[model samples]
Target: MKIDLDRSKEPSLREQICAGIAERIRSGLLQPGEQLPSVRQLAQDLGVSLMTAVQAYGLLEKRGLVESVQGRGTFVRERAIATEASGDPFGWQLAIGDYLPRASFWSQSAVRLPPEILDLATASIHHSLLPLPLLEASIQSALKQAPQSLGRYAPFQGDPEFLAVVAGYLQRQGLSLSTHQLIITNGTQQGIDLFARTFLGPNDVLAMEAPAFSGAIDAFRLSHGHIVPVPVDREGIRLEILEDLSLQMRIKAIYVVPTYQNPTGSVMSLQRRKALIDFAVAAGALILEDEPHRELTLADKGTGRLPPPLKALDPDGRVVYLKGFSKFLFPGLRLGVLAADGALYRRLLAAKSIVDLGSPLWLQKALVPFFQNPQLPRYIDRLNSILLQRSRQVADTLSRRLSPAIRWQRPQGGMHLWVTLPPFLDADSLLPEAHRRGIHFLPGSIFYPGEPESNHLRICWTNLADAELPGALECLCDVLNEAVR
Candidate 1:
C-alpha cells in the first residue's frame, strides 16, 4: 500500500504508477527486493486498469531500476549500478529527433525578467553599463539629420552608413570584411536558424558541443536536423570526435562557442581553435563561430585574457562569425551581427527578407549610434572590471567553504562555473526548495536539449550583488543536502 503521488502533473495512468513507486524507492520507503503489488492489484488499488499497471512495470524495466520475473512478483531493484544509466546528453527526448522541452521548473530560467530580480542565470549587464545615454543622443541626432531614405525599404544589404560604421569597427579587430559581407539579424538565434535552414537538409547531421545551449538545440529542431553530439574536455569541443563525426556521419557544419562557452564556461584554447579550423576546412564543413560572451573576463593571478577570435584567424570564409550586442549591450534592443563572405551572405539576405522583412529597420537604426560614440570604449572597460570582480567573488567564495564532495573549475572569463557533485544531487529536485528559500539556479539539464547527468549545475554569479554571494551559496548547499537526504 506504500505509494507517493504527483498532484500537479496530469501524467498518464502508467506514469502515475511508475512515479508512485519511484518516489517511494527514492525516499527509502521501499527496500531492495521489496515486492510491488501485482499488476491487477496495483490497478485496482490505484483505481486504474490492468493495462496501466503493466505499462508502468514496462517503464521501470526500461529504466533498469526495477525487476519483473516470471512466476514471481515485481520487486524494487538494487540502487547501485542498474539505476545509474539514464542520461540525455543532448536534451532530446530519445535523441534520434525529439525537441528539448525548453525551460522547466528545474531551470527557473526566463528569457527576460523583472528589473528588480538578480538574474544570475545570464551574464551581467547593468542598466548603466553600456553607453546608453550617448547612444540615445546620437540616435536623436540621426533622426534630425536623416534624409528621404527613411521612407524607402533598405536594400537586401543592411543600412549603408551603419554597415560602414560596423565595417570600420571590424577593421580595428583585424577582421577585414566589407559591409556587404555582413548581414544584420534580429539576434543570434535568427542567424543560427538561417544557417541551419540553408545548410542543413532533413536528417543531415550537425555537430554541436554536448549539453550545448538550449536555444541552439531549438534552432536545429526547427530545421529537423539530426544532431551528432561531440563531447567537450578542458580545451573545448573534442577535435578528434568532431573530425570523426564529420567523416562518419556526413556532418553538415559544426557550431561552437569558441570564447566563453555557455553552461561549462570553458574557452577553446588557441591550439584547439586552430585544429578545429583545420579540421573543418579539410572536411569541407562550415564552422559556426558563436562569440556571444565576447571579451568579458576576470583576471587570473598571473595569466592574461586571450585576445582575437576565430574569425580573426580564418583566412578563408569557411567560418561564419556570429556576434551579438545583446549579451553586452541591451537584450530588449535585439541586435546581432553576422559576418561571412559576401558570396555566401547574399543568399542569406534573401532568406532573411523572407523571414522577417530584414530585422526591424527602426529598432536596428535606434541602436546604431553607439559605433560613433567615443564614450563606448570607456563604458566597456568599466563593465569588464565589474564583471571581473564578480567572477572572482564567486570563485573565491566557493573555494573557501564548499565541501570536497563538490568540485568546480574557475572560468577565466565567462559568467558561470559548471559544478559537479556526488551523483546523488539532482539540480531538478533541489530547485523548488531553493526557490522557496529565495535562491535560484540555472539547472545543468536545461542547457542540454535532451537527458543529462544528475550531478551537475551551473551557477552564474555575474548579475548578483557582491554581498549576496556568501548567503546564496549557503542556501544552495543546504538545498542540495536536503534534496539528497
Candidate 2:
C-alpha cells in the first residue's frame, strides 16, 4: 500500500496518517478483513517514527476503524466498514444518549420567544441600553491598533493589553490582581466550566448555594462532581451549612454569586463573605466567586458601602473570582474575566487551553480601549441608574398588584426579582398560562440541584420597555390570582 504524507500540513503527522487510513477504510479502498502494513513497515515507508505509525494505528483502532489480531495483522474492523450500509443515519446519536435528556431540558428553558411576548425570563438588558456606537468605534480602533489580532490566536491566559486593563480596573474595585493572575474567558459561563473541569472529578464534592445559577449546576454536573446544596437566604448562602458540609466531605470547591446573585438578587453580607473565605481557606477548597452583577448595584440608600468581594477579603489564594460584562453591556460581546493566583490560575489556564485554545483575540482587543477609558465608570453608573429604576418599578408593581400573596425583596440593584408565590401556587405550573398571556418567566425549580421549590420564580425587569412592564405584571398577577382561586 502506497501512503503519501504531507510534511507541512496543519495536522500532525500521526493525525494525518490516522485520517488517511480511516478515509481509505470508509471508502472501501481498504476492505473489511484487509490487513494494513505493520507499524515498522509503515514507519519505514512513510519515513516517520515507529511511534508515529503505532499511534496512527492506535487511533484508528480507537475510532473502531481497525482491529489487531494476535500474531495475525491489523485488519479493518468489519463493523466500521458496514456502518454506511446499515442505512441508519442517526446511529451516531446513540453515543450521546446519556447527555440528551439534560440537553433537551436546557434547550427548552432557552427557547426563543416571538417579539409580541414580554420577555421576563432572559437576563440580558434591552438593546437600547447597550453602547453600540461606542462599541463599534472601539472595534474599529482595535482593528487599527492591532490588525493581526484577527488573524492569530490569543495567548492561553489572554491578551496582555486587555489583561492589563482588566487588572487595573479590578484593582480600583478593591481587589488588586496582576495580569498574571487573570485569564480572559468567552463569558462567565466558560469561566465556571473551566473551574469545574480544572478542580472537579467524579464524586468530588462541589458546594454551591441551593438555588444557584443553572449554568454552574450544569457545568459541575457535566464534570461529574457531587453537588452539596447550601441554602441561601435574603443575605446570601448559608455559611453554617457550608461549614458542616465541608467537615463531612472533602469539599473540592465552593461556587457563589456574592453580589446581586442571579435569579435571587441577594448580596452576601460582610460577615458571611469573611466567614466564607475563612471556611474555604481552612478546608483548602477554592471559592469560585461569580460576581457578574457587582457593578449593577443600585445607588446606596444610606446602607453605607457594599461589602468587598470574597476575593478582596481573601488573604490566601483561595478565591477564583469571575466577572462578566455581557449582562450590563451587550450579551453578544461575551466578554468576562477570571482571577486567581499561583497554581490554581496555572491549572485553570491549562484547562482553558484545552477547552477552546483561547477566547477571541479581536474581541479582547476591542474591549481594551473601552475598559481603559476613565469615563467607563460614569457610563456604568448611568446604566445602573436605569436598572435601579426598572428594578424598583418591578418591586412596586409586584407590591401593588400581587400584595401579600407574592413575597419578594425589592432588589437594590441587578436585573431580577426573586418572587415566592402562595404555597398552593406552583411557578412551573403557572409558566404555560403566563406564556399563553404573552408573558415569559423562569421558574425557580431549574436553579435547584435537588428537590425544587414549586412556588418560587425569577422575573427579569431589564428587558422590557417602560410602558410594557405594567401590562406584563398585571398579566402575571392575573395568573397567580387564578391559580390561588
Candidate 3:
C-alpha cells in the first residue's frame, strides 16, 4: 500500500498513517482478511519509525478497521471490509440499527456559531460573566495547599473536604444533606445518566414534565425507560396529572426541574412541591430533581422569597437532588453534586465509580475555596442582575416587535423564555430563515416526550450582552413577520 504522510499537517505521523489505512478500508480498496505490511516493513516503506507504524496499526486495530493475529500479520477486519463492499457506505448504521438512540435536538444544536449570529439557544452563561480572576486564584491556591490532589484520583464518592463544602452549600439553601449522601459527578448530565442507568430498567415507566430538559429526555430514552409526559403550566408541572398517572401506572421514577426549569422558566409552587413529595412517598417512587439553575432567579417583585426545592420538603428520602455548577459558573469546571440517601446513595455512588472512577481531585479541591469565598454570593447576585436586565429586554422586545403573533409568560427567574407562536406557524420551519437573518433558537419539539408542538420555541437571553439583544430581537421579528406573510 502506498501511504503518504504530510509532516506539515496538524496530525502526527502515526495518525496520518492510521487515517490513510482506515480510508482505504472504508473505500473497499483493502479487502477483508487482506494482510498488511509488517510494522518494520511499513516503517521502512513510509520512512517512519517502527514504533510510529506500530502505533498506527494499534489505533486501526482498536477502531476495528484492522485485526492482529498471534502468528499472522495485521489484516483488515472482516466486518469493516464487508460493510464497505456492500456498496451501502452506511451499512454499519444498519448493524447498530435503531438500537443507537438519536441525539436530542439540544445536543445537536450545540455547535460553534458564526460570530455574527444572535445566539438565543445556548443554556450557558457568557464567558464575560465567568469569574476568571477568582478561578485563577483558586487554581493557584489548590496547587499550593493541596498539591497532592493532582497526584492521585479522588475517592470514588468524592473528596471529603469538597463533599463537606458541597453539603454546607446545600445547607444554606435549606436542604441539609450529609457528606455520605452526596456523590460528586462530572456534571448534572452524568448524574442524570447515573440515575437513569441505576434506578431504571428497560420499559420502566418514568413520569416527566411534558416540555422538559432535552438532556433528561435523552438520558431516560437511552436507558430504555418509557416516558409519560405530564403537562406544565405557568405554575410548573401539573402535579394532579402526575398523581393520577402514578396511581394508574407503576412509575419507577419522576424527574423534575422544580426551580427555573429548562426550556420553560417555570418554578413549581410550594403547594405542588409538598404534594409531589407526598405522592412520591405514597407511590414509593423516586424523584430525580434537577436544580442546575436553582440559585439563579430574578429578584421576586413582592415577597422576594422563593420556595425551597422539593428535596428540602421530602420527608421520606424519596428525592435525588442534582445541582450543576456549570450553568452559572465556568462551563469547563463540569462539576455537579448528586444528593440522595440510604440505598439510593449507595447505588449512585457505585455507578459513579464505574463510570469515571471519580471526578478530578484538583478541580474538586480548587472549587472548595471558590465556593467558600465570601464574594461568591455577590458574584451570583451580579450575574442575576445582568440576567434579569437581559430577560426584560427580550420580553419587551418580543411584546413590542412580535406582539399578538407570539405569546409567553415572563419567567420569574432563569435564562429562557418559552414562547408560543401562532398555531399556523411552525418553529422548526422558521429556524432556517431565522438563521439566515443572523438569529437562532431551540425549537420546542425537542423538549417533549410525545408529539412535539411545532409552534413553540425557547429563547435564552443570558449569553449575549445587553447591547446585542435589540438587534437580535429585531432580526427574529423580521423573520417571524416574513414567515406569517
Best model per lDDT: 3
Off by over 4 Å in 1: 1-118, 147-152, 300-307, 466-470, 481-485
Model 2 — which ten-residue stretch has the worst lDDT? 95-104
Model 1, TM vs. native:
0.75
* Winning model by TM-score: 3
| Tens digits of lDDT, candidate 3, 272-324 | 88888888888888999999987788874465678998888989788999999
lDDT of 2 by residue, 7-115 (tens): 7655789987886566455434455766678899889877999999999999999978899876766878875433223456763442231321122126445578888
Candidate 2 clashing pairs?
A: none
Candidate 3: list runs displaced more than 4 Å. Answer: 1-94, 105-107, 110-112, 300-302
Q: 379 in model 3: Cα distance from truth in Å?
A: 0.8
**Every model's Cα RMSD, please?**
10.5, 13.6, 13.7
Rank all candidate structures by their TM-score, best first, as comma-separated numbers: 3, 2, 1
TM-score of each: 0.75, 0.79, 0.80
Residue-by-residue lDDT tens digits, candidate 1, 1-485: 43333345556667766755664454344557666778887777667778888999999888765887666767778644233333636423221322222223213443344454334465546565566787678668667666444665665556877778878876765578888788887778788888887888666778898768767865775565666677788778999887666666677688898787877878889899888888877877888888877656666435755756888888778888888777777777676778888566766777888887766555556555777677776776777788777666677767776776788888877667788878877775676566677677776765554346667888777556656666777777676655555
Give the alpha-carbon lDDT of every model.
Answer: 0.70, 0.80, 0.82
Q: What does the lDDT come to for candidate 1?
A: 0.70
